[model samples]
Target: MDTTTHVAQTERRRTSPPAGSAGPSAGADPRRGPKRLSPRMRKLTLLIHVIAAVSWLGLDVGLLTLSVTGRISDDPETIRAAYVAMDVFGDVLLIPVALFTLVTGVLLGMGTRWGLLRYHWVLTKLVLTLVAFTATVAALRPGLEQAARDALRTPPEVGAAASDVLVAPCVALALYTFMTVLSVYKPWGMTRFARERLGRPGAHGAARGK
Candidate 1:
C-alpha cells in the first residue's frame, strides 16, 4: 500500500474502539459498574439481611424492656440485673446483628440492579445503617458498659442520670423501624446515577427488560 493509505489505516485502527465495545455504553466505563448476582444468590442475601435486621430490632426491644423495668422497679437488685443483661445482650447479640446486616445489605445492593447509589431509598438506607452502626460502636456499646459498671458500684442503685441506658435502646428501635419501612415502601425515585443510566435513549432497556 501507499504511504498515505497505510497512515489512514493506522489512524482508523487507533481511533476505533476494540471489538465488542461499539454499543452506546461500554464496560470500560467505571460508572457502568459490576454485573448482578444470580437470582438464587440475590434471594439468599436478601434473606440473610432481613433476618439480621429483624434480629437487631428484636434485641433492641429486649433492651428497651429491661430499661423500662429497671427504671420502674425500686429494688436495687432488679436494677443491677437489668443493666448486666443489657451489657451481655449488647455484646453478644447486637454487635453481630449490626455487622451482619451491614455486610449483607452491601453485598445485596452490589449484586442486584440496585447499585448502591442508584436509588434514593437505597442510598438513604445505606446511610442510615452506617450511622446506626457507628452509633452502636462509638456510643451505644460504651454507654452500656458505663451503665453496667455504674450498676455494679457499691450502692448498686441506678444512677440519677442513667436515663441513657433506657433512652438509647428506644432510639435505636425507632431508627431500625424507620429503616424497615423504607425497605418496604421504597418510595423515593431514582437517584442521579440511576437516572443517567436508565434515562435517554433506553440504553439499559435490554438488561432491565424483565
Candidate 2:
C-alpha cells in the first residue's frame, strides 16, 4: 500500500506543469495581452489625425479672416453668409477634427507600448493638450465670438488679434514638434517614471518583453 501511494504521487508530480509554465497554452490569456494593430488601420488613423489637424488650422484661418475684416458688408445677407460658413465649418470640420485628434491621440498614446504615463514628451503634450482643448472650447470660441461681435459693431483695430491668429499655427506647429522631440529624445528633468522606462523603452517594455 505504501509503495502504490508513492508511485501514484510521483506520477501526479510528473504530470503537473513546470514552474512558470501556464499549462497547455502558455501565455494565451485573452486578457492582459496586446491586440495587434493592422497596418491599414494605422495608416487610416494617421491620415485622419493629420487631415483633421490641417482642417482645424485652415478653418480657423477662414473664420478669422471674415471676422477681422470690418468692411465685409454688414448686409444681413453677407453677415448670414459669414455666420453660415462659421456654423458649417464649426459643426462639420471643427468638431469632428478635434474629436478625431483627441480620440486617436489618446489611443495612440495608451494602446501602444508607451502606455501614456511613461514618456516625457507624451506626458508634456498630454498636459499641453488639456490646456489647448480648454482654450479652444472654453476660451478661444468665446473670444472669437466676442471679437466677431465687437468687430461687427465697433471699428476697433484688432490687427493684434489677427496677427496672433496668423502666428498661432506656427506656434502650435513648433510646440507640436517640441512634443515630438520629447517623445523621441525624452530628455529627463522631471521625476522619473519610478523606473528607467522613459521614451520608447517604456513603451516597448509595456507592450512587449516579459
Candidate 3:
C-alpha cells in the first residue's frame, strides 16, 4: 500500500472502537451513586422520608428501652408505667411514623431514577421496611396494649407474659438499624432490571452524549 493509504488505514484502526463493548463508562457498577433530585417536590419528599425514618428508628429505641425496663422491674407501678408508655408510644408515635416513612420511601423511589426495583439495596430496604411495619402494626401494637392491660391488673405480670413485646421491639430495632445502614452505604449492586434499563442504546447513551 502507498504511504498515504497506510497512514489512513492506521488512523481508522486507532479510532475504531473494539467490537461488542459499550466502552469504559458502561462497565461501571450501576449502584455507585444516587442520581440527583433536582425538583423541589422530589427534594421535599426525600426530606420527609428521611425525617420519618429517623423518627421511626428513635421510637423503636424508646420502645426497646421500655421493654427492658418492664421486664426487669419487680415493682408493679414501674412495670405498669413502662407498659402503658409503650402502648401510648406505639399508638401515637410509632404507627404514624412507620406508615409515613414507608409511604414517603415508596414515593421517593417511584419519582426518582433510583427506581422501586432497580438497585438491590433499595429493593432489600423496601422489603425490610414493609415487613417491619407490618409486624409493628399487626403484632407489636396489639401485644403492647395487652401487656399494658395486664400490667394494670391487681397483680401485674409483665415479666414473661409480655415477652413478645420485648422480643418484638428488639427485632424491629435491629431491622430498622440495618435499613438505615442500607440507606447510608447502599452496598449491593444493581438489580437485573436496572442493568437492562441502563444498558439500552438510546437511554443511557443519550445522557452520556449530552
lDDT of each: 0.82, 0.56, 0.83
> What's the distance in Å from true for residue 53, model 2?
2.5
How well does candidate 1 score on lDDT at residue 133? 94
Better of 1 and 3 by TM-score: 1
Off by over 4 Å in 1: 1-35, 197-210
How does model 3 fare in lDDT? 0.83
Q: What are the RMSDs of all candidates, in order?
A: 5.5, 7.7, 9.3
Tens-digit lDDT track for model 3 on 37-56? 55998989988998998898
Model 2 is weakest, by summed lDDT over 10 consecutive residues, at 189-198
Q: What is the Å distance of residue 121 in model 2 from its true position?
A: 1.2
TM-score of each: 0.77, 0.55, 0.75
What is the per-residue lDDT of model 1 for residues 172-209, given as tens digits with 9 covering 90 to 100? Answer: 88888888888889876566667676554453564467
Q: Which candidate number has the best lDDT?
A: 3
Model 2 lDDT tens row, 1-210: 699999999999999987887764865632222434466776676677677656665766676655444334546445544544554555456656666666777766666544456555667777776665665666545444544444444343334443443344355556556765675586653325524433333644555444
* Clashing residue pairs, backbone N/CA/C < 3 A, model 3: none
Which residue runs does candidate 2 get wrong by more than 4 Å?
1-36, 60-92, 154-174, 180-191, 194-210
